[model samples]
Target: MRADGSGSGTLSRLEIDSLKAGVRIEDLAARYVPSLRRVGERWVGLCPFHDDTRPSFNVWPDSQSWYCFGACRRGGDVVDLLREAEGVDFRRALELLGGPPAGATAGRGWQSPLPVAVPRQSEAEPELTCEDRAILNAASEIYYQSLMTNAAMRRALQARGISLGTAQTYHLGYATGRRLARYLAWRHLDLERARCLGLLHDRLSGEDGANGDTSGDDVWEHLSQRLVVPVMRGWETVYLIGRATREAQRPKYLGLALPKEPLTGRGRPRRSQGIIVVEGPFDLLLLHEWGYWRQFELLALLGTQFKRRWLAHVGPDDRLLVATDQDDAGEAAAAELMAHFPGQAVRLRWPEEYKDVGDLAQAPDGHKIWARALSDA
Candidate 1:
């Protein structure tokens, strides 16, 4: 455990403000100081910061704050508790609350105790070209409409407990082997744009010379035989992802190589009080079926690596619920999400019997378990 909180990633003032406003110090303190007893409106327990025979630590759930009237006399919000308990600096504290890695390069790090943005860097992300953006949008829509017409794709959703209506709401679609190239040709869309979206690779002049002329032999449809789901920011499509429809597909999922949008002097992302991040789009579909979206802003990250663009989707005041798959990679993704977020983000662990939320939905008592987790959260 490195306690040198020198500096690393940077968090904005707004993000810090949001974290302080979002995390309740009492719940945080409970992680360090156990055997807490509620008295009046505060939870009193021994201060873990120092040796104490009597309970001198008081955490106010209503105020969403904490303080110690004992020897340590050192008390603050969840960030402070993490700092002292972990013997790390404010930056490390923020990381513990989901800032960045403790050993990341040094800087002012985050000014706010709470972080809701990705670790600040010295440079901004490169902008996507118009053609790149166009292909993403077109391919997404093409796959979605194509999925609606495919019974196998719809059946895949049904097997997962996802309703067709839910799929439609998400604009879920399928990619027929060569439909995109034909559509592009019919619409006179740019072939270069299609190539950029990974829907087409460079056709060799020798091998496929005249083969490209026919739709069946055309190798342009990148996500062929997969269900396409567009990753959107509000109403705008930002990225395109594919889930393999066949069990024999090696990777099971595929994605465009386009870079996700990062925060760019955009003031601040809209606050939704609470945000829930899940692994695949289908997980979101399941939650949507249960109307969970009404309670929290549900975000499906397609696969879990915690894209930089997702930072702009979160507000400093937002509380995050990470409900990723319960596996090694999923756990890694959850850790990454926490590192990037300064706000209060709790990972909702599924029972050992279930692999993920989507898998759990198939269990008879799954909804009951889900409801319990929500109620406890």
Candidate 2:
């Protein structure tokens, strides 16, 4: 835990050797580089330590070692890979691999001979005020009620494999564009605050008698005519993201003026195996619909970037099943995330025909396809 990796000395040589023997170097290397493919006896992939253009990273299962023949030009055992990828010291790496050796006491004064570095923390979400909570709660309720009555919207969702039960479970809603302003006024909520939160806009308001009346028709809903996906933390709606329903809509998604957080699923089982990370909210919804949530915690990145802040939800030993889209950007994002958690992440390999989980869900045997993928992981 110290900057100089001083605390690592407590672990005995036997403990370090046990940790090294328990983990396979080639298997650990594959987590950092998902593209690793077998070449005769050795596996090869692009080097994760640097910008690799060719297959210069080599992993030998026979020797339990890896070497990057490209830009990094370095090679070592599993411990070296963990230290390099996680930016931790020998003691920390051993701890991450499998805690202290049996019968080792924490009170021991022994120190690790190897040096260590401080691990980086992700940026924290901005603090939300009381007023912010009130506005978000009201907006979410109004949208939920709106979706209940909109038969067309319900039918649209059904066509996409999202059922009425699933929609209600996730608190999915529809934005009427004209409802929020009036609802906030009826509740005597501050319209200016809502505008500041990216829920309302004043582009249509004219420069007439400037009395600062935002509750009137002058203000417009920011997510009008789009499907609402409220990112909730327990009972509170922390963030709201909207997806365009119509094909003609230019921007596919929109969000409130808040830090982007992964849209998570409800009730993660106490003994869940790992986190199932997907690209879009729909992809997550379909997975839940097919009963994947029973075994794994689900998270939708909402986009390609995976922030370090999200790591708080993951347990130290839990694996990350990266099921992003099969496209170029998704592949790149998965690789980046895998590299961040070497030996603890696996890129879920989807069938080549399907571009993503959402597309795969449309097939008659979509559930089976996903089951097979998870089993392999």
lDDT of each: 0.64, 0.76
For model 1, the stretches where C-alpha displacement exceeds 4 angstroms are 1-124, 202-216, 260-273, 307-309, 312-317, 339-343
Q: Which stretches of candidate 2 lie over 4 Å from their true place?
A: 1-125, 205-216
Question: What is candidate 2's local distance difference test score?
Answer: 0.76
| Alpha carbon lDDT at 267, candidate 2 | 63
The TM-score, computed over Cα atoms with residue i paired to residue i, of candidate 1 is 0.59
**Compared with the true structure, what per-residue lDDT tens digits does model 1 show for residues 1-377?**
22222244444443444455545566667677886877534577877877777776766553355666556644555776777788888766665565555555433354444433443344654566766666667777778888888887789888878788778677778877667776776767787666655566433222221112335353445466777777765545777767766655524665654553221111123544477778777677788777776666777776654556565756676788888888755776776677678557777865777877877789988888987776676
Model 2 misses residue 288 by how many Å?
A: 1.0
- TM-score of each candidate? 0.59, 0.64
| CA RMSD per model (angstroms) | 19.7, 17.1
Model 2 Cα shift for residue 189 (angstroms):
1.0
